[model samples]
Target: MIEILNPTSLPQARETGALVADILQTMRSRSAVGTNLLDIDRWAKAMIAEAGAQSCYVDYAPSFGRGPFGHYICTAVNDAVLHGRPHDYALGDGDLLTLDLAVSKGGVAADAAISFIVGDFTPPESVALISATERALSAGIAAAGPGARIGDISHAIGTVLSEAGYRINTEFGGHGIGSTMHQDPHVSNTGRPGRGYKLRPGLLLALEPWVMADTDELVTDADGWTLRSATGCRTAHSEHTIAITEDGAEILTVAGRAQP
Candidate 1:
């Protein structure tokens, strides 16, 4: 179920991407030492509805996760990495928070994620973990372009994580996004270049690089969701939805300014 989007479809994707980015940004801003996770979920829901966009997470029933996620967004804190179900917990200073969001707008879907420290006291390890994922994400995006193989992107992403002394996990990585949140052409975080699917123009891919501080293994929380590091080490994740174009890849989920 690979989806390709032409130039026109890119705008709708930008809208979806912008909504995701803005929501994450807003949530991060509003989040405080005592802010409850449920409040964050509520904020996300309000923004999604206000944008007239549909949440890819709510009512999601993926096999790996508990049926019908029933959440507006993924609120991963500290050890929690992916599929974090919001619970009754208040954020604390220096807590590592990750927000992953996906939304469908005008029939196109865009997904993105961001990790940041909650308050002050940014631990060096936490900052390093977040920086490593961001660096890997940048490398992966840079390797993406027309005529490049999916392996190229994977290799670029893996190199950064490996160089930073982090183990690679292939169970989950980037994937195609359009018309729906997740699609075909699975992009692993580590692979050989010049192999796997050959990328081309009009293809949309969500490139995410995530890593745990010490282990490649993951444990699921009692809730049947919320993947966490096996050793309880800190974690970080970075992601963005990108569209392949004639000259190169266009990142639809950039936060600040538009790239030329």
Candidate 2:
């Protein structure tokens, strides 16, 4: 469902966004070589509980994924890109990890994701992948605002990835997110501007730009949740939740902000 949050509800959205951001930042700070993915999941669980917020993923049972995500956060590593279910594996040096998180608090929701290299071994390819996604995310955000169409955002994101020589996957992209985690008005990583849904005030959108180093194909992991690159090439994803306003778009999920 598409949800246009009211002005009063904006505070709750911001609060939820801040909480998600803090949890992600805390997790990122704590994650390192030898850190277990399951441990990260446990940390997410504890933080969410402490904040008195609900996890949007734990009970997520969608047609595409295995019923009930059964985890606190998504932990994608190296070749993995999306819906990465936390496992028992420990992180290694030079591992590219993507952490995607969403939470609900005060009856509102916000979602965001970040990709970074673990440990001191940062491969040039991995760094490039992460940088491309981040730049595309910024472009997407810059294209967003009241009166802007969803396609405009998509085009902006696509230009960056394509110019970076990465292949774009349209299957899973950004979407409208509010009281619920995923909603209508699917936003693709690449598209034609001046098409698709028009932006309006009070609308919340989670624009994510993800790409694979080589091929655009994806292969599902045995776990039934993690999505990986078909060629086993490294992948990266970056996301942010923004609220459309009269002046422009207000980013809701930037990390390192003082909690409200």
Question: Each candidate's root-mean-square deviation in Å?
Answer: 2.1, 1.0
Span of ten consecutive residues with least summed lDDT in model 1: 251-260
lDDT of 1 at 97: 93
lDDT of each: 0.90, 0.93
**lDDT (Cα, tens digit) per residue for candidate 2, span 34-143:** 99999999999999998889999999999989789999999999999999999999999999999999999888889999999999998999999999999999999999
Q: After superposition, how far is residue 176 of candidate 2 from its true place, in Å?
A: 0.1
Candidate 1 has which clashing residue pairs, if any?
none
Clash counts for the predictions, in order: 0, 0
Model 1: per-residue Cα lDDT over 35-119, one tens digit each: 9999999999998888788999888998998788999989999999998899999999999999999888789888999999988
